[model samples]
Target chain A: MSIIIRGARLIDPGQQLDQVTDLHIKNGNIEAIGDLTGLNAASEINAKGMILSPSFVDILTYLRDLNQIQKGTIVSETQAAASAGFTQLCASPDTQPCSDAGSVISMVNNKVVSAGFCDLLPVAALTKELKGTQLSNMEALARAGCIGFSNASYDISDNNILLRCYEYAATFGLKVFVQAQDQQLGDGHMHAGATATRMGLDGIPVIAETLAISRHLLLMQHTGVSGHFNQLTSAKGVNLIRQAKAQGMNITADVGVAHLCFTDTAIDGYRSQYHVQPPLREETDRKALLAGIKDGTIDAICSAHQPHESAAKCAPFAATATGMAIYDMLIPLIQGLVDAGDLTWALAIQALSYNSAAIAVGKTPKLSVGEEANLTLIDTSHYWTLNSSSQLSHGTNQALANQNLKARVKLTVKRGLVSYQM
Target chain B: MHNLAELQLTKNGELRHFLTPEGLDRLMLERILDTADSFVVVGNQEVKKVPLLRGRTVVNLFFENSTRTRSTFELAAKRLSADVLTLDIKTSATSKGESLLDTLQNLRAMHSDMFVVRHGDSGAAHFIAEQVTPDVAIINAGDGRHAHPTQAMLDMLTIRRHKGKFEPLSVAIVGDILHSRVARDQIHALKTLGCTDIRLVGPNTLMPQGIDSMGATTHNNMESGIDGADVVIMLRLQTERMASAFLPSAGEYFRLYGLTTERLAQAKPDAIVMHPGPINRGIEIESAVADGPQSMILNQVGYGIALRMAVMSMAMSGQMQQRQAQALVSSSLKGEAQP
Candidate 1:
């Protein structure tokens, strides 16, 4: 269907365009930009005070569709993603059978095609079944449409095997995604600090992240591989990444949006919803992460959208599951950051759209003519509470539920199709 | 959601759930101590049963193996005239793959009034109190490294019986403060009970980070930690500490921080030594010191029965009062609707 978004503040970081303009989309591609008021279409959106940007790309997310359909399905999660203004998701490989084999990749692709809410890029496992012992068939899996390779929170204890995996991925010119964490030191549930001590819960020291980042930096440099760090949660970790970048390492990194908004204090009273992997760090670290984003040291911010069933988060803090169902509240949270003046609108859009797309698929999302119409219109002044009735994700494990938030996704056009609308 | 402290109290500040000592104020804590003092008389009587919870059912939900603690709670419930059911959860439905919530729900179906939970995970009792069955009273027996309220109360009772007042006392807690739920609860209770001179004695490795901010001072040397102290409470060093690299050896620990007669002499002449026992004779304390005249170790265990009875009855009464208030409110609403 053809459509027109009229008189909206169109901010496209990829094309370096920011202006109140009208854009025309015809047959799933941008037909024209700059005053399309005279153009007629099948549908029209009067986005007068809204901000329209390229639809977000989440480089790390868990669909949990394979054997854990009880947690989430491809259709449900993609619909949630669409509502959150994300039109592309890089699905992590920690599935039931894992995305190690070419068949798993094809199965995921088939499911995504059938679902058709958004594009799905599967990240194949770096090791067979993610056991960290044997390497997976990376060359074959890459050819089967895997976007990248990752071990997904599982640690490769043997340095030699990890080095070999990096070297092999480098040979195929494939990007390797690393979730840096020292397995032993990351045994605790939350960040190591005074708060964790006060609450009597075990703490995961900051070194768990920095130590892993340091080791991975050395390995990436040694193997000459394209590397990307996922979910950095500490100040030292950000500094290390900055230093590595300054030393001319061709690498990029993304921080989880939750880490930017919360700290170890959020886990007070043992609220299981705040329990996350690479658990939230201190305030200084959160500020450092935001600074890293503002100064362009951190390239992107991901929803890190791990959706789980209610039962997963119902237990005591440590025994409960480790993630928040973030898709339904992702945009409002980023908007909250912008509203609080911690993030500029342009930088937020660039990190969520342009930088994420470039890192994940090596393509920049643009609002120029002839580009695909993957964009969302957001009502920045709109306010709403995220109760169960308003939540769209199948997972009810949202930590931000029942909280008032500014901004809402008013319209999302994916490849000229009305993927979502309020 | 209400915190553990908030969940433990009613609107007017009555005890509802005894989850932790962290939230109980001086008045509430003193009430517990006073109630236990009255129950001490009941313990001395021939027929030691109270009619406070006569028809109530108290379930002893032990997820971890704790023979001593389970028996104390079971006996306390029985003494309160409540029907008691002890479930060794490790060998029960938990092992059969039933979740904690599912098991608690099934038990709640049987109309139990309270759950005395001893779980290995921190905040387990709070989860039960808040999520599983809000109507049922939850008495935390020992939840991970979080709290052991009844134990702390019993220790407080022992201290009060020996020494006059908490304000005039210098209390020293020794060994394994990092991993002891008892230490955490004791710190909170001691602080609330007006004990300002609280010293935590152990190696830096055994001390929890930021515990000093909780109104307790940390000392690596036992001599300085116990100097001028009126009460010395030693925590048991778990055998797993060695396997986990928390210590070099039991002998080494004894040599460094153990409570020997010589170390005991560092405190006041009449200072009392206490251990939440199952104590290691040579590891955390010397046998001579543990069995000495100034040792209040046995008294702490003896006070456990009365202390548990006090908290159980108080929390049950709080729940009953809340339910009755709710009933009155709903009945009044219904009456108004009839008009």
Candidate 2:
């Protein structure tokens, strides 16, 4: 049995689809990219005025499984992920017991595979429980099929330690993602800018992020092993990543929607919900990020969906939580980008669907005759108000709460199977 | 040791216990200075050693964790007298379950004499002073970021050795005056010694909310902060203490509010640098100037120990004498010694 999504504006940046077309799905694979009206399938989805595109992939996610619990379990996470159009999510190792080994990866993978919804690719931890003193069994984790590994949620202070992790990652054929920050310089809890000054908030100087990134990039050059930079939040950050890409180094970078849109100025009303590490930068940095995205410098955009209980971010500016659940907010954020002229439908596809799938499977996503039919159906132009009622994640920290956003998922098909419907 | 003043007793014509800077008068501070002079010279020897604190017990009861303060106290205690015992009870146990009174009671039962007390909550020293039954002395390292009396004394010693007397000199405490225990102690000590025209400098965020009541003028700019002052005291920014308060980034604070060489030039040519250690380098000040010719930072560290030793001995001996009289009366009333 196969599925056919009909009468949709199927935009595949990889295949350069801008006009309305019909897509054919058979046995969980893309059977046809042209007019599929003449072909017959087990199920047909009327996607009029909706986008029949590949489901978005996220390179950062948390999926833990030790003795009992997995991160929301693969079924639960994938259900939530599908509702938000995420087909593949890289499971981070920063879990309950902390994913520091191959058994950890295999344990998580088995649980996700058994749950069966979306692919839960494990991102292994770089150190022994990320202790920063010893290395994890990179070889064993690679054998267990971890796409990438990280120290998770922070940067290691020792340059030698990081360099070794990078070198070890290279041997395992996995890219290392550094959470960029100068540890000693991170004594403060807010962005190092005017808002922190006026509010009397402790600050993590933007230099801290850039300083770590610069060192990591330099080390990458020396080690000749490419590294990935995540959640860049400053104008200096924009230039560093742009320069690194221009220099032809094998470095890839991404930013959260918060950094792209929010700034330290948001703390004007002391909206503690907007608090984040690498603090939301200034308008100047936001503009720089927009420009970076316009170019090929910023390869992807991620949710950076860190879920902390309300008690964590419930405090005043100095004591509030550092992150919010953002996975569901990604589509609306990109929709805003499209409306603002900073992004095109084509570029948005490249950053979200194509690039994400590429990162996961180590290859680009194209709407060819034989590519896998992992497609998400959404009305890209539909305007709807977002609320916590629709989100499936355990956390409700989305900053875009109650905000009007474009697009709502209609159907989520993974591997030619109807995974979800709304 | 219910009262700090009662801790001292004249034993063979020597004062004991160092508890207050007010009583550690000029002669006593000067003697401690001389003692420190010998230690400073001895520090250059093959091994820094003396049998001074050989058998006597010295306990570092810091309820607060200060890298510089603890290390210097340890160094000073080692050089001066008997055994040095550092009991850092800043962890969960001291803050909650085991009360400060209980810990002091347990330690006193062991026959200790000196306690260099540094605590986050105010009145820790006064509370310990009230509960101590042994012939013990309490040295206020710092409390509630309120007053670090020994630091003030050492600063005074440094100033006196450089500027001669405190009666007519102008000294300004720059950087964070708001949450600095050092700033408060410095102000009290300077005011006591008769220093006129003290200026409190830095951003309003860093300066004490109402320092004018203390007879000190407030200045926001580096120029006004140091303007014409005989000695400028730089208070290291207490970044760790910025939890409840949002005091901006160290970079912005440093650029707009830090003390630089040019800023220091607005003061007297003989202006000396003084900071409680482990400088935030680029945050609170510039390195070129902190390590430059005008810095008396190392001298402050050296003087801190001697000042502490003097106060400890004075307080301890006072308590010994008071407790001895009580003991004498109790024995007489009991009609006979146990034997």
- Highest DockQ: give the candidate number: 1
Candidate 2: stretches off by over 4 Å: A38-40, A64-74, B1-174, B177-339
The residue-by-residue lDDT of candidate 1 on A206-268, one tens digit each, is 899989999999999999999999999999999999999999999999999999898888888
Model 1: per-residue Cα lDDT at residue A319 = 78
In terms of lDDT, the poorest run of 10 residues in model 2 chain A is A63-72
CAPRI-wise, candidate 2 is incorrect
| Cα error of candidate 2 at position B123, Å | 26
lDDT tens per residue, model 1, B1-339: 236567889877889899988877899999999999999999889999989899999999998999899998999999999999999977343332236878999999999999999988888898898888999999999988888989999999999988979999999999999999999889889999998899999998888777877888889888898998999898999989989998999989999998889988899999998888898999989899988999988888779999999999999999999989999999999999995
lDDT of 1: 0.89
TM-score, cand. 1 vs. native: 0.97
**Fnat: each model in turn:** 0.60, 0.00
